[model samples]
Target chain A: MTVSIKLARTVKDLLQMAQTEYFDAGHRTCQGCESAMVLRWVAKAAGPNTIVIGATGCMYVANTTYYTTAWALPWIHTQLSGTGSAVVGTAAALKALMEKGKLPNEKINVIGICGDLGCADAGGLSEVSNALTHTKYNFLILMYDNESSANTDIQETTMTPYGALTTFSQVVSR
Target chain B: MEVVGTGTDAVAYALMLADIDVTSAYPIRPYGGVMQTVARLIADGYLKAEYIVAAHEHDQFEIVKHASAVGARTFVGSSGVGWLLAIEAIVAISTDRYPVVALIGNRALDDPPGAYGVEHNDALMVRDVGWLLVWVDTAQEALDTTLIAYRVAEDPRVMLPVGISMDGAFLTHSEHVFKIPPKSKVQKFLPPYDLGNRKLHPSNVISVAPQVNEDWVTEIRKQMDEAMKNARKVIEEAYRDFAKIFGRDYGNPFVEPYMVEDADVVMVGMGTVSKPIKEAVRRLRAKGERVGFLRIRWFRPFPTDDIIRYLSGVKVVAVVDRDYSFGSPFDGGAVFTEIRSALYEAEHRPLMMNFIGGLGGREITYNDAINMFNMALDAARKGRVEQRVIWYGVRE
Candidate 1:
């Protein structure tokens, strides 16, 4: 009897090994934030078969500047707080495409990334409620916890810690 | 990779390293930085997934959950009021059995006009929704937990969502030294998202939330309950595997005990508050006070056996909660409610008292935690039940 262990480099390695071309660049924000890195990596990892639903945030304004773009794969900039419905629409579209024998059998991964304030504070409940009710699509929800309204100079969110002062705290306290 | 960064960025990096396929974003206060960072990843070519900017948080969740149902690893986050607003989605994500990872910023609930800082109420309010909740005190923990969360949430036995809560300013904004593990190591730990072909085929249509009778509902709930019960072991296993690859270990899903082995009184807390409480406990121990600290690590599927075992010999227990459960006879302490229920006995129970502090982002300093412990000791000495709930660091 022969024992064999076949090891394909883990998903992480495959992602890193895959070469990424800058489809979106020259954005001014945190240089090494996870949101920026994860999107770039996923674009390459999921190959050209992926579709992105871009909501209103730093990602949309900063990365997708004018006609010059950051996404090499199919992408859409949906309304703020309505990416959930948009992604569902895209999933439905993809499923329809597959049914029409238009798309190949390669798996398509749909992803949703929102900030803490967006998901936990606003618009997250309804989107999540709808997703729960309908379960045909495949998606990923990546939440970022920066602990401030970074675009607006560190305003406090519901996630802020006690005693840590924020822009709103001073205003509300005063 | 070694510069000062927010936990939100670290979370994105972790997802990228874990090979997440889909991404979505909606911006709100305190948590907007995370989306900003993910946007940068798109620009820098570090992350290559679909980056969707939804109209709002609800849309972001729908995108992620729908993707997850078809076996895509998903991520999302919110803070304070954002979290409260996302509460409905939290329940939906869990009930649907999607492996979504949320990075929630802890903030106080509105009402009584609290500060814009960290509080546990945001996550506590949604604990009953069946998401696996863990609080990280630092950026590194935030990143590590995000990776571990996916592994735990995606396990067949625990196909549930996970919430990795962190303090807004403390861990989310603070910079720290962290190692970006080699891609090979990360890949070895997290496998690609693979839902069987049968479930995802176009012809094989199945309803996710079918209208069912009580028995079907009970069975679903039971499965969810069992999945949570099994998550403890899955979390532990994932931690062990992560440590082996990344050289960091997130302890078991039980309260972190500090000097409790030989102490007469113990103070318990969760999230960022635990960091200072640990230091305060050390100071008390150095000063010849037999005091200890128990940091609650896992919030949901409350560690009943571990809490009972750890506090069984202690003479007194002081449970500090950042959120209050209003209108309760116990004066609205959430941690107290859970701890008391776990320790409820017909004969003997530890003299458990509750202290609510750090509401609406108010700080719980070393002095505040120590004073709470002292008050608990005083109550223990008298052998009389003190007020069931006390507020710490509040002025009359």
Candidate 2:
């Protein structure tokens, strides 16, 4: 094979070897940013036994757009700020099942993600409070900073830079 | 394959490349793009991990922190007030010493005057919240910063969560040349996340953020403070490594200064606002104005020394903010009151002025920046603090 072709084949083989099951094709959305990249990498890096609790946002809309999804492993979509609570519930269930010897011997992993505006600006306080106050689950939180409400057009957010023009600032003049 | 895109996708791609294992999200203006991209990756068979649709921003953190404790790398985002909603969690994650990385889209806070676009107020409000905060001037930085955030947060010396801020649209929607680094390179930078068996196990149970005496609290706080101080070096080191492998470097990793030497006046701001202000400064310099600019790359931990050193020689300093302090004796001025306070004992403290502008997606023009410079010069000459804070570009 040509060098380029050989490289592509090697990548494919490595991907296959990793045996990541959470990421699959068909989920809609842009690929230029880190949101998709995180999901892609996470699904690949995570082991075979894993469960996902998806919260409301572009991830939910795109992945579950047609009900048919690319999530190879078990996944569920919960309330906007409830991903944490759901994961807790899932972890509790997993522990119960494991203790009952009903769960397989595979090592299981659980995870969560949210936008900065969602977790830092919206109902993030209570959810995070619960996480700190309780120690039922262990996971990583990834804050994707796109700096805009993409579902909406270009608008300023808490993370917006001072003196940078945006739609809301346009209305008021000095 | 080629496809339509946004900066959010770029950030998602960067995290995926970093090997994040868990994901959570919520919908809000300006940041919905991040979630959209995560959803797409799951469909493309590029990742294998759990994607959770959080009930709200709070739950998002809860899930991510839980997962992190159990040794899963997680991700999330939000915009404007949505970010404010998550502020409490932002502090909690840092205090818990969880290695969560949050990407914050800067926007205005709701109050007397309302807006929907870029502002530094929200991020500034939490400057002392014990998180390692990095603000990116471009989409590429957004991607690179996320990678660095993880490495920095995971450092045993700095196990505090990180906040990576990007301006709305300026970095999120703007296109830029980006190279998807090799997986092996990423592996070299970030090792497999080891949770140290902190999760719930029958043999051992430990409390996270358990109630403790003042001494314990003081010690924990001291450790966090030291970690932040140490992070300055860690950030510089990570950027050096990134430059070696990725061919990009953010100088100093704390602040970026432009043409400040021999400058009589210096303009200070962060994120995309700094870009235009820099251009405006060039214009003023052409007209014989000895003006300079400072872009704050790291907001949290405030980089007080850097600010003092850069402003020491300047005759006048102008601080432009998009968010207001509201009800402060400063008359609802920009959030730089703290910066002014830090300069109290400086030997050559220049005349300082604060201006609130470009809030709620409003545009801050080159002319507006020029006007701010003139105002600063006028204040410096008077040798008296004249209305320490001025609302630039405000309408009656």
Candidate 3:
């Protein structure tokens, strides 16, 4: 029911614990992919009690590139606008099982990972906001602010920084 | 207990009797009554459940999906664009196989000249998304179908969501006397909500609705298709159980026939519109026109085999569709298209035609039903329809 992002100090310490990284190696993320790094850290810290849900974004494309999955724990990938809905569904199912005493003494955390495009551009803003507002089935949405639609080759998204050159956002002279 | 209330109220009563663990609601006209009733029940301590007024319809759907996935017997509802707005969640819940029951106060999607009226477009929009659909014609059926919907959706053989669609204003607002089974009987009938092995839990520690390669995706889809096909039997069983307890049976869970035994022309349709068609058929039969009416209660997992069996002796068939499927190669509505497809292989397929009427809650009166029957009679006698598809009740 709690989501906290703690900075794992130093490359030495991160690499020392890399052997236990829940998001295992061998994915197609670009070199310097901030979203990928965030995913690894979040997956590692959240541990096996967590179920991660990813919207149609860079993480979904790169991490789950078919024939492989980087997540050592349960992971669900849904349509761009379905991150909140998917997490809610997973969380609800888990909670219902727990309440019915069917899954005694078991609790599963539901986490949603979505890129900036998913939050603002992929028609998920309202859905995410709604899930958060109605917190009956507690879940968290990690809106990775990568500024661009990195999955679509770094195309400009609404969250893209001004003057940054993306495939769709070039420095234009009036 | 018998109560005189609208269809929405009946649904709320059923939700309470089913012991819904969680439900979220946002107001949509024609469906708002359901949420209001639920909230009141919660406040008065008549219902012990989680009830939240959601930010919007999309949020409500997400809440319902999650709550259900988490092992909560959840209920949610909306109408028209309200339901359409939640299509994202609807499709996800279905694919993920969450046994969430959605009560749709059936309304038309915003046509150019929009109005708050009944139409099947909202439910039909995601008809292929792998959910069990049951359309009710009365407040009584609304209550009964909803109770059955929960059992059917949560059935291990099914494990798919169910949509209880009632016409907006017409069914949603219309008051009728219906019996509400005692909670003890309901408890015995529905049992406790359990996903069994299908639920999400740390003990299981397995992914749900995960990403898959081409080799696995096809299989997953096929698995879902198999589950939907299996729903027909489970749906029928649930109805039989309901009837045994409630003492009111709607003939069959999938489709019900009305005076078709000796008729040569059969008029087919669904939902509240079919109510008047029954009367029309009665009047036509009295005049020796030899007509009958068949109402389809379950639209999804369409009972093609049962329909063919029922229409075995019929000479002419007419499908009255309140929802249009635009650009169909047959240039007909969904029900018509499905009926035609089912009859294609029949050795003695009757002269069949489609009649589109009652869109946006336009009243399809006995007169309209009579006209449709007469047209079917003409087609039966002539062995061909004057027009393959007729837009009944439309000006021009």
Top model number, lDDT: 3
**B125-161 per-residue lDDT for model 2 (tens digits):** 6677687777888666777788888888887778888
Which DockQ value does candidate 3 get?
0.41
Residue B221 local lDDT, model 1? 86
Model 2 earns a TM-score of 0.69
Candidates, DockQ:
0.06, 0.05, 0.41
* DockQ agreement of candidate 1 with the native complex: 0.06
TM-score of every prediction relative to native: 0.70, 0.69, 0.90
Chain A TM-score compared with the true chain A, each model in order: 0.74, 0.74, 0.84
Cand. 1 TM to true fold? 0.70
Pairwise DockQ winner, candidates 2 and 3: 3
**Candidate 3, residues B1-396: lDDT per residue as tens digits?**
878999899998998898887787888787889999999888887877766566667767776776675578899888899888878878878888888898888888875545778888888887888988888988888988888998988888888999988889998999999998898888878977776765555555444555567768787778789999999889888888887887887777788888888788998888888778988987887788888888998989888887888786689889999889889977899999988888876767888889998988889998888888888898888877789899997899
Candidate 1 residues A1-174, lDDT tens each? 011212337887555445454344644447786677877765555554455556656666556654346666545444445555655745754554454344465466665555656555455546644644446666655556567555456778666778887777764533
Instruction: Give the CAPRI class of candidate 2.
Output: incorrect
Off by over 4 Å in 1: A1-174, B1-3, B111-115, B197-204, B213-215, B345-348
Among all windows of 10 consecutive residues in model 2 chain A, the one with the lowest summed lDDT is: A1-10
Query: In terms of lDDT, which candidate is stronger, 1 or 2?
Result: 1
**What is the Cα-based lDDT of residue B324 in candidate 2?**
76
